[model samples]
Target chain A: MSDAEERKRAYRLAPCPAYDIEGTESWLEDMAEKGLVLSGDGFFAGVACFWKTEPRQLRYRLEAAPEGTGLWSGNGGLPAEEAVEINEAYGWKYVANRGQFHIYCTDDPSAREMHTDPDIQALALNIANKRARANMITALIYFMIFPLIHLRGGVLLTAVHMGSGLMLGGLLLVLIALGRTVARVLHLRRLRKRLSAGEAPHRKNWRRRALYHRRSRPIFIGLTIIWLGFFFQGWSNENLGGNIMPLEEFTGQIPFATLADMVPAGERAGVILFNPWIFQG
Target chain B: MPRKALSGLTESMFYVLMALCRQPMCGIEVADFVDTKTQGEVRIGPATLYTILGKFEREKYIEVIEVSGRRRTYSITAAGLGAYAREIRRLQRCLDDAASEESQLGRESRE
Candidate 1:
């Protein structure tokens, strides 16, 4: 195979900085200028696949897909067929979509901007704002419920008993996810407010923002994988009785002593009180 | 989908309904009608137009008359006509009230 044919597909961390619509569109256009065109298949596993092609300018626009279009319910990341037809007629080709953000591309410079009215665009973004708010609530509920669910030994105690590195990593992951969700919600709200005030969507400079995300994504992914590893290890240990030992076998400093330590072994001979086995880290 | 109560039409919504009242029109045709009728004062984006279309359809304010290659032509329903008529009356009343107030002020100034 020829060099270009051999290297047909290239994958990059999707340069969507928390649904910054203009930034993402600019970043995708920038990618096309670098001969890395976004593939029609779209992003998978947070990585966008691009075709290695000759450098060219492509205008990428991100349109917000409102709820109940069934696009979110596993319609293969494509917008409604009717929506696609309408966009295509206006010279914009429907590309891949990520969640509610549908990406469109056009080489035509005069593709009559996807959305002509800011007020309408704001209405579309309301869906995203609602979704973000829902996510923030969910994250908040998880943040509250998680500690209570793990309250038997407490999250920190469990960390110490199970795997400190793993538990800490998991905690960090959850905190980051929650923070991201809240940030997205706030950003969407602000954008909607601006749009409703009749302000057009601004084209933000994507270079610096894209650079920061590209640098940070790999580290974030690595940490996530490590956290996942620890999570599964802990899960297996719990179910398979791995690292479980009787209290007497535990050599670590015991905060509380059992009945055997408090009373004479002969005095407690026939009666069994509490199970003395502890799951050790 | 459960129908939402109409709480007064926005300028765009009112224009869209007005455009549909003339005859059945597709999305692009409706957009064009609104643009031309307002002499470009009011412009409806594609997303907004579709959103309004979807909403109107849900509220029984419009019905699809033709579906040719994703270009669905819609006509205003009886409910939609009623809404448009109500809005027109509402606007007329506002104009009448303003005219009356201005004439009363003129008479008071003359006195």
Candidate 2:
């Protein structure tokens, strides 16, 4: 197989992040049931690697790292070595991790549920919320700053140079990233409120929401494909001076005055006289 | 659980503290004891058990007496016993108050 094909074989991106952890876990479980087991996960929010295997019943758990729990930075950093050691001790094999939540899976049906107490689950989610809020602040900073850099001069002029398609593609990506981040933060806040009220977190769980829904996965995958296509198309059309050269514009400076100037009525459109750059009849 | 577990001990927490007061047991054993004592009525989630154990340790209510393989044995401290006894007394008082009210109501009915 070619190198590109091999690389494609290795990685398949998921539709969401650990913030939509419930959906991701459920999705992973479904994948596992289908004999595609998630073996590793990368840093990118939507990236997950899988291994083909015999179908088996598997249970996946996502736990928000409690405050002062994770070994390293705490406050929702990572699951520490000790934490992994302890979880392994408890028969939970570590599967993957993203942001504040650590993922684990066990095939034992009677291995016991990850969370028995809703109150403690709520507290763990609270710790995760602080981290989620922090991420949103960081996103807010970038969201505000990114547009300023792009909109430095003016929108119309930028659009003309960058190609409206290109700009729109970028804007689409930014809006999506912002939307997902904001939605996750809001979901956490709602969960936290329910938890603090001594209500169960699973009542109207965030897993089945639109953001984490199975149907939304296709939309995200489609968007990524479109974004990549548009971005590459724009990238290839770029000029040396950093100005965009759209596919329509030819090397000649003069715009097509009339269809007869270049069509069968005038001359053959293929040949170009390249002697010191001059158009000849 | 609640921020102030002292205010009202959750049934699981209360049992955990109660079991530990009697013997130094590992996590699974504690869970088993609770299940058996309640005649399989109350079930503790592993996550909840770990969280409660961690909190109890943090508060010095329970101290780790031994670690054998993956199992860490914990026994209740003086504070844990005190808390458990206090909760029991509170529950007893409430029950006693209900009985007294019932007797008074019975006397009124007789009249």
DockQ of each model vs. true complex: 0.44, 0.26
Query: Residues A140-188, candidate 1, lDDT per residue (tens digit)?
Result: 5665346425643576677776667666667677787678767777777
Clashing pairs in 2: none
* lDDT winner: 1
Q: What is model 2's DockQ versus the real complex? A: 0.26
Q: What's the lDDT for all of these models? A: 0.76, 0.68
In model 2, the runs with Cα more than 4 Å from the true position are: A1-11, A67-91, A134-182, A192-281, B1-7, B63-75, B97-111
Residue pair clashes in candidate 1: none
B-chain TM-score for every candidate: 0.93, 0.88
For candidate 2, the docking band is acceptable
Candidate number of the best TM-score? 1
lDDT of 1 at A22: 75
- Residue B110 in candidate 1 has what lDDT? 100
Model 2 chain B worst lDDT run, 10 consecutive residues: B1-10
lDDT of 2 by residue, A84-106 (tens): 55555456787767667777888
